[model samples]
Target: MASYKRHLNKDYTVMPNHHLRNKDLSLKAKGLLSMMLGLPDDWDYSINGLVAISREGRTAVENALKELREAGYVVIRKLYPNQTDSGIIEYEYNIYEFPQDEKVACQDIVYQEAHNQGTCFQTIENHQQLNTYKSNTYNKRNIKEIQFDLTGKEETDKCPDKSTPEIELEIDIYTYNVQIHDEFEELWKLYPNKKGKTNAFKSYERECKKKKNPAKFEEVKKGLIAYCEYIKATNTEIRFVKNGSTWFNQRCWEDDYTIQNGKNNQTNKKAQPEYELL
Candidate 1:
């Protein structure tokens, strides 16, 4: 996908490109803002409405909104039941073209009329409805996700960046407590030693960053395969096998390990990986 937007069609509306270029906003946040800009004026701007169509869950949307609001692209206002502000009716989200300073939302004529009448916005009809939305929550496979609209469909919690490669995509789940590369998972499956996977992955990621190249996944994979073979050929016991973390931490992939009558090991800086992953 194009990293930059181009206005090639008349059917589209234009928006500031700063959101795309903003160093502070994440990829998910940028996509969400672009989506909001594409929405029609009469469309539902409720949190639930936003959540329904998103591949991300409520938490992702909430965090993105918080970032946008702080950057001035979004303004959230609490609507009250009456002029006295005794009861909250609902929140009104005002999307802006530019970052706005902290101030009361500028209302349109229709909004003014509704507020002066001390009535809820057209979406929110009464106090009971407001309480219903606020009180309801659902257990989403162990994660407590707040349900703002009973009518909204479930969200998948996937990253919004469709342009990313599959390897990168797997690493960017952002939530649901998953943060390992597909290549590393493969390595884990092939390794003879199976301890401290969490630490191993952390070390794996750190090692990758040192190379700053994910394309070398094959190198790591081949290294693991060779190491596992060395263990089998040497008849190394499980208790004496090197931990996965130790393999990465010591950069053992460079070691020219061998079985000398099923007993000797060697090391060299120029040693190449042996054995294919499959």
Candidate 2:
């Protein structure tokens, strides 16, 4: 069934959709994650708290949380009672729009804990008896971060690289051909060149989030297929093919595609003649 036309003009939160598109997350988990992320940071985040706002029963909500946790979208920081820890003091739930590995997630937790430090973290001294250097808030806050370095050595203070660059093609996502939404991976698979997927997905998300005229996912699919065929039909080498990120950034699909006889165009080998787009 077709969706009712959406008018995305007001009262919207622009958030990343990596988790929404994640194949590992169940539909219920995805919906739950999306809803939780939409809440303000000061939300009373808990199992029952989410159940109060959602139609899902307690069991379903619990299951969704489990899925989110297993998928790395929901990270739980448990503060043990003491050195001989018996119970948790408080549970800190860290939610992410995108899944992250253990290493990055550990660092991410440090960043979060540091933001609310002194209240939650204590300066545990290491064997070297070296003074713990104060860290200014990595996200530009003036507050110092509580250092938890285990090496008895100072860690270099630096902000995490979280910026996803945006390319301003400024083209309407709607093309002449009408279509439905599909996964970004399909476009990745269809694209001949495979480099810069992280940025390629970012560009894909940019087009998908076009204010009122977001991209038709099928247009991306058709465009990728057409582009692939053009490359093959023209005997273009892989080296001559554009990177996935560059292709998306340039809005290459909007360009009129041309193709010629591979044999006849030996002299103008770099140029494409014309291929009728589907």
Candidate 3:
């Protein structure tokens, strides 16, 4: 069996003097060319084939091929007539190679130019082929990759791991059954007549000012009211959280000890004594 050899050609379209100038070829184009030269001619490749090997999509492969063709290094024979599969076109490529003399001459001219610029090089031909090509001819070494398009694939929220545990939320509650009259009387006693009323209005105004974010305040207010209803139904304990930035008392409730003590104090002494005896 004949061993496959990737052929490099002299028909490169790059200006003869610029052939060895690495910047003359784009990284992707250089890579594609190198790959084409190294791979056996018997092996077939397409734009998609380059996309798969380069892990870059069709556009990248196309750009590389375009660059190679423009440089006159690679010739392509399109294998298929334009045909669409579900609205997408398909195509294949057959690349050609050229003589070696022109390849060496191209490399030589580039090396001499560089050598004149104070860049020292013992000899161009002696330089490692791949390294010399990469260092002198190609601008981009690393291939830019894009994710494969999976527009038509079905997806599910299935977890790969079965052992990951689920978590549950802890729900707590609090209740405040305040008597407005009693609180008003207490305020009157503390501030005295009109002064008490004035102070109360000022405090309310200040609180409203503190609750500057009306949206957040409204949200908290609704949540607090729901929380109050929960306490009324379930009688669970809840602590009020105040918005520090806004001086808004979003919600308030006594501690568990205070609640229990208050409940006990609200009960009749005789009833308490009877319950204790029981």
- Stretches of candidate 1 off by over 4 Å are 1-7, 83-88, 104-278
In order of TM-score, best first, we have: 2, 1, 3
Of 1 and 2, the candidate ranking higher by TM-score: 2
Tell me the tens digit of each residue's lDDT in model 2 across 93-187: 55666775775345323223211111111222221111112211221212122122211234222211321000000001111111112477767
TM-score per candidate, chains pooled: 0.34, 0.35, 0.24
C-alpha lDDT of candidate 2 relative to the true structure: 0.51
Worst window of 10 by summed lDDT in candidate 3 = 166-175
What does the lDDT come to for candidate 1?
Answer: 0.53
Question: Top lDDT: which candidate number?
Answer: 1
Per-residue alpha-carbon lDDT of model 1 for 1-278, expressed as tens digits?
65987668677756778779989888987888888777765464444567898887766786787677667776545455452232323334556655654443333212222221111222222211111112111111111221212113543334343321111212222221222366678778888878777777767766654423332577877777778888778777988876777666656776777767755765656444432122
lDDT for each candidate structure: 0.53, 0.51, 0.32
RMSD of 2: 22.8
Q: In candidate 1, which residue pairs get closer than 3 Å at backbone N, Cα or C atoms, i.e. clash?
A: none
Error of 2 at 15 (Å): 1.0
